[model samples]
Target: MMAAIATLLATTTALLFGAIGSRGGKEPTRNPEELVTVPAAPSKPIRTSTVRSQPSAPIPLANLPTSREPTSPQLALIPKPNAERESLLERRKQAGDTGILPGVGIPGGIPGAISEPSAANALVSSLGAGVRKAAAGQPDKAYALEQKDTLMAQGTSIRCALQTRIITDHPGFASCVVTEPVYSFTGKHLLLPKGTKVMGQYDAEPDSGRIGVIWERAITPNGVNIDMESPGVDNLGSAGHPGHYSAHWGSRISAALWISIFSDAFKYAGAKYGPTQTSTSSGIVTQDPFESNTAETIQNIAKQAVRRAANRPATVTINQGTIVSIFVAKDVDFSQTIKAH
Candidate 1:
C-alpha cells in the first residue's frame, strides 16, 4: 500500500513541471516599428556648395592702387572746328578751283618753285641748303669753276703731227706738235700758235689694228697750260693716228700649215673603224678607248690652235712724224694762254 501512494505523488510532480516549461516557450510577437526604431528623418542634408560670404569693408579712395602715367606721348588729339576752313573753302569755290589741298595757288616766284614757307617747305629748304654747303665743298678748301673762255668752239678740228713712235702692244705717253694755228670762232683772232705742244696717253687695249687715244692736255708756245681732253683722229674724220700695219704673214702661215697637218692626222686616227677581222678571228675585235679619246682631244686642240693663228691681231706701228688730227671733243679753253701772246 505505501509503494502505490509514493507512485501517485511522483506522477503529480512531473505534470506540474511540464505545464510551466510550455508557457515560457510560447513568447508573444512584437510590431516591426517597435523592433527596428525608424531613423529620425536626416536633418535637411548639410549643404556642401553654399559659401558663407564675409561682408566687404569700404576702402579709402586715396589708398587704392592707381595706374602709372603713360610712357608714350599722347598721340590721340581731340578734333576742333576750324573757322577759317569754311572761309578758305568758300574762297576756293569763288576762284573756280576744287582742290583738296588747303593752299593751292600759283606761286609768285619762278615756275616749278614754291614761294610759301610752310613747316614742310621750310624743313626741305633747310635740308637742301645744308646738303649743298659742306658736303659738296671740302671743309679745308673751297673749289669753284672759273670761266673756261675757249677760243675754238666745240667740234673744232685741229691739225697736229705725232712726235713719238707708238706701239699698240704696250701703254705709253705720246706727244704731238700743232702743224697749223688755231683761230677763234670768227677766224679773226689767232688762238694757238703753230708750235703749240700737245700731250696724251696711249692706254687703250688693242682692238685688232685700230687705236684711238685721248689727248689730255695742251701747252701753248707762250708757256700757259691749258686743259684739252680731246681725241686723236685721222684727217679722214676717223679716230687715231694713221700709220703702217705689219701683219707678219709668213710666221702665221707656217704655224697654220703645221696645225692643219696635225689636226688631219688626229682626225684620221679618231674616226670610228667598224670591226675588221683577220683569218685568226678571235671574238675580241675592239679599238683602244684611251687611244681614241686622246686622238679626239688632240684633234680639237689642233683645230683651236689653227683658229687662233688665223685670227691673230696685226701689229700697229705708228712711227714718228705721222699725221693725226685732234678732235676737240669739248671746248678747249686757250683764252688765258692766248692773252699772254
Candidate 2:
C-alpha cells in the first residue's frame, strides 16, 4: 500500500513538469540580440560613361606604289589625264574651236557656253523663232532617263569627237575622247565619264574614204583600262569614219612631166631625115625591126611604171573634231574598277 501511494505521487509530479515545459518552447529573453537584424548601409548610385574613339589618319598619295601604264608595260604616275584633257577641251569649246558644243541646238541641251555665231545657230533659231506664241505656257518637269547598274550594255553608243586628224596611206594609230558622261543601264551610276580615252589603229592603204574603225580599248577617267573591240558608227548608226579623199596632185604632175620628157626622146630613137637626091621615098628609111621593137617595148614599160606611181591611193583627210560613236559590241563591266560615291 505504501509503495503504490509513492508511485502515484511520482507520476503526478512528472505530469506537472511536462505541461509547464510544453507551454514554454520559445528561447529565454536573455538572447534578444538574435531577433534583431541591422539594416545594410545605403550605397551610392552607379555612374555611367560614354567614351568616344578618335579616327585613324588618312594615307598620303606619295607613299602609294606607281600605277601600271595602260599603253605600255612600264609603270607611271599619270594622274587624272582625262580631267586635264576635258578642262582643256572645255576651254577650246568655249572659244569656239569645234564650232559647236556637245549639247548645242537640242531642246534639253547643256546650254551653249558662249554665243554661237549667228551663222552657226541660224537654222536652230529659225525653227523655234518662226513659231511665235502670245500666252505664257505652264512649266513642266524635264524628262530624264532611269539608270540601274554599272553594266554598259552592248549596242550602247559612246559619242566622241576626234581632234583634227589626217591619215596617210600608211599604218598608224589614233585616239578619241568621250564627249559626255555615259550613264549605266539603270541611270543610277556613271559608266564612262566625259573625256574617256579610246585608242585604235588604221591599216595601210585603207580601201575607201569611209575608213572602218575598230575601237580597240578604252581608259576611264580613273585610269582603269576597259577591253573593247567595238566598231565605229556615225550619228545615224552607219558604219565607219568618213573623210574627204584628196588626190596626190604632186605625184600625178610628176608622172605627167616624166611622160612628156620620155615621149620626145623615145620618138626619134629609130633615125633622122636628111637632104637626099630622091627626097620623096628614100628620105625616111625604115630601121631594123629589132631596134625599133626594143625601143617601143622600153617606152611602154616606162609609161606603165609612171601610171602605177600616179594611181596609188591618196591620203584621207578627217577634219579636226569629227564626231563618231563607238557601237559597243560587248557588255562593259566597271563594278570592280570603280567605287560609288
Candidate 3:
C-alpha cells in the first residue's frame, strides 16, 4: 500500500507539472505592426571595364585658369586673326618677299604685333663685320692692297743677281742686285728696276750642312724700302721652291763629305792589294796583304772629321751677279710707296 501511494503521488505531481509546462510552451502571436524587420546594409558593386569609358567633356574656356596671363612679349609670338593673316600673306605675295613671318607660325599663332630685334640677325651682322675685317687684312694692319690689284701674278718671273757671294760657311744678311728688268705681265711698267736690291738672310743649321735663306725685303731704284711678308716666296723655274732648296743643299754637303771619306778608304784598300815592288833577299816578290789597323784608322779619322764638321756652323752664300727668279708674294700698291725708315 505504501509503494502504490508513492507511485500515485509521483504521477499526480508529473501531470500537474506537464499541464503548467504545456501552457508555457505555446508560441506567441506576432502583430504585423509590432514586428521589427531590419533591412540589409547598403553595398557598393565592383564593375570591370571591357572598353575605355567616354572621355570627360572639355572644360569651358570661361572656367579655364586665368591667374597666369601671357605678357605682351609672349603674346607677340602668337599668330594674328585668320582674316588679318590672309591679308598679310596676300600683301607679301604681291611684294614678292618671302621673309620670315615673325611669330606667325609659333605655337600660339599670335602675330608679332611689336617687332623685337632678332638675335639671329644680330649674330649675322657681327659675323659679316668680322668677315669684312678679315678680308681687308688682320685687325689694325694696313691693307696689303688698297683696292683690287696685284704686284705680280702667279708664274710671273723676276730675274735678280746676288750682290754679294753667299758662302755656306758664313750666314748673314745678304742681298742680290736686280740685273735684269722685271716687268709686269703687260710690260707697261717695270716691277723691279736694275740696281734694286732684294735682301734676305741665311739661317745656319747646327750639325747640318743645310742652311736656310729667307728672302725678306727689297729696295726700289728710288731707295724705297718694302717688306716681303706681303708677297710670299714661291717655287721658281727648275730651281724649285725655297723650302725644298733649303733642305736639299743644306744636307748635300754633309752627305758628300761622308761619301768621299768612305771612297778614300776603299781606294786605299785597293792600292794595298795591287802588286808593288819590294826589296828583300828574294828579289821583287808580290805579296797579298790585309791591314785591319789601317781600316780602323780610316774609320777613326772619318769619325773625327765628322765631329769637327759638327762644330763648324753651316753657311750659305749667294755670289754677286747670279740671276734669281722669284714670284711676288703679294699684290703691292707701288703708288702707295713707303719711304725708307
Q: For residues 179-278, what per-residue lDDT tens digits would candidate 3 score against the true structure?
A: 7776654555566778878877764553443234566787887877766632223333443223212334445567547756775776687667745445
What lDDT does the true structure give each of the candidates?
0.69, 0.70, 0.58
Query: Per-candidate TM vs. native?
Result: 0.42, 0.46, 0.33
**C-alpha lDDT of candidate 2 relative to the true structure:** 0.70
2 or 3: which has the higher lDDT?
A: 2
Candidate 3 local Cα displacement, residue 293, angstroms: 20
Candidate with best lDDT: 2
Mind giving the per-residue lDDT tens digits that candidate 1 earns over 320-341?
Answer: 8887888888765555555656
Candidate 3 Cα errors over 4 Å, as ranges: 1-150, 184-187, 206-211, 230-306, 310-317, 338-341
Pairs in clash, predicted candidate 2: 146-186, 147-186, 147-187, 147-188, 148-186, 148-187, 164-320
Candidate 1 weakest lDDT stretch, 10 residues: 72-81
Task: Order the candidates by TM-score, highest first.
Answer: 2, 1, 3
Could you tell which candidate, 2 or 3, scores higher by TM-score? 2
Model 2 bad stretches (over 4 Å): 1-148, 247-254, 265-301
